[model samples]
Target: MAQKDGSTGSRERVLAAAAAMLAEDATAKLSVRAVAARAGVSTGSLRFHFPNQRALQDAVLARIYGHLFPDEQIHDRSLPARDRLVNCLRQALAPTGTGQQARETWTKAYRTYIASAPTEDVRAAYRAMDQAGRRRIEYWLTVLADEGALPKEDQASRVRFLSAVLDGLSIERALPTDESILRSETETLYTAVDCVLGGA
Candidate 1:
């Protein structure tokens, strides 16, 4: 059913609601009908916005990416490579909230997404997002090379390796209940980086 005024805002509201639901429960068995019911919209309205699960998944990923990485200048040449890398990793891993409730909720949502056994289309969507993230890593690596911290020839491979490490750490430590643990692990990772770069 069209909104009385034909506002697209209603469609956006439904998408946002679906993203929240997906974030909260990974195995929620979602469908246009279910999401429509959850979003307080008619089934026809949900279908009008998203015709299939793949469409819904892509929309959800887009919303999540926007939330996770807002429009911001991510790299600064003025800072040392290590500092810039640390800043990027921290931003990527920063917890969204201070308390256990928020941490658990966000962690659960992230875990669900990571565990997704998506369809071919959903997998392609994930791959595109992964490539974007890897590009960010490569950008940092290029900056590091310009700063003489790493060799320029292997920058792409090096960034992929570093990104994998950071992704592992994000899954492990990003949801810490204690700020001390988060700080300690981050400092430990930075120390490892320092040792590696010290010889360069």
Candidate 2:
């Protein structure tokens, strides 16, 4: 544990230091001593905040998830459910073309998280996120079913399958910086929807 000379809680300071380290080195090299040094705190203070390595790792994982999939309000109700689904998929899978540096940083962070999977806390975080996504997918499937574009009884299966497809494609697209390949991935979402909905 470490204690900071300045107030504002040593745990927060330690988490901030860990996040900065990840930003710089692409993954958390979060030893208590290293984090304390970075935060200008004593090792005992760090322990007070996070009793063990796993506790610190859990915080880091939570921060990473927050950075990657931030909560945002979507206001556009005019678009069809299918179109909205496509739009969400595109935004999630494609780089927004803001700048190469920003995209590269995101790519690096994403890869690091992927490589460190199976942590219990991380798995729980993933499940919560996945459940939210599944709810949205089920909403879209219900809309399609109402329009006779999808079978009523197939809602769960279609949503599950589409969710899996989207998850796999996202992981694949994260592997490379090729814009063409990413574009292909976005297009594949449309194809997947078409196939799942019986190819209208």
Candidate 3:
């Protein structure tokens, strides 16, 4: 069932609907058939785009990040190591495709994960997205270590540690008050980043 509006195809509709579903449920009830129904397409059409759970997960992550930083310039690989980390965190805090650069998205994501405890597949999908974020962070961290900006002994652990902190902060993004409060939270995040990277 092709939608009347101008979407690319079943693929685009599926991803769009899936992302919205992920936003609302606070759990990963992201079954193929369910998503298909949400997209108003057949399961076959949905699978034609996603093929499998991991594929769908990857697409969801890609959709979120891609929309957040469509013209990404920090991934040039030639920029300074510190700049990469800054850019990485910048993207992390950016508003999503729907201009939700605030904390509500984090609340929804947390809710989704809480709801996902009963389903290993949904849990794995969440972990996959988290790992994807970690991998991006790791790339910049590795560059920093290579440039001698970060410690070499525990690079892997360092990335994981920082990623965990950042991810947690991301969840608390919507918990701030006024502008001053937001600034305070932002400073806390920067401090955590500094703590993780061992200060620049």
TM-score of each: 0.49, 0.46, 0.52
**What is the lDDT for 102 in model 1?**
49
Candidates in order have lDDT scores of 0.63, 0.64, 0.66
Rank by TM-score, highest first.
3, 1, 2
Question: Which candidate has the top score in TM-score?
Answer: 3
lDDT tens per residue, model 3, 1-200? 75564335878889988888866653555899888899999887777777886568557756765676666544456775555676667666565311245555765776788755748877776767776576566555554665677675665677788777666555555554445634654676667667766654
Q: Candidate 1 on 108-178: residue-level lDDT in tens?
A: 75655556666675665666556656655555555465568876565556656666766666545545444
Residues 67-156, candidate 2: write the lDDT tens digits: 664541122457654566677656655543334544574576566556677787666555656665665555555545656666767566
Q: Which portions of model 2 miss their true places by more than 4 Å?
A: 1-84, 92-119, 177-179
Better of 1 and 2 by TM-score: 1
Error of 3 at 9 (Å): 36
- Model 1 TM-score, 2 decimals: 0.49
Question: Once superposed on the true structure, which residue ranges of model 3 sit more than 4 Å away at CA?
Answer: 1-84, 96-103, 179-182
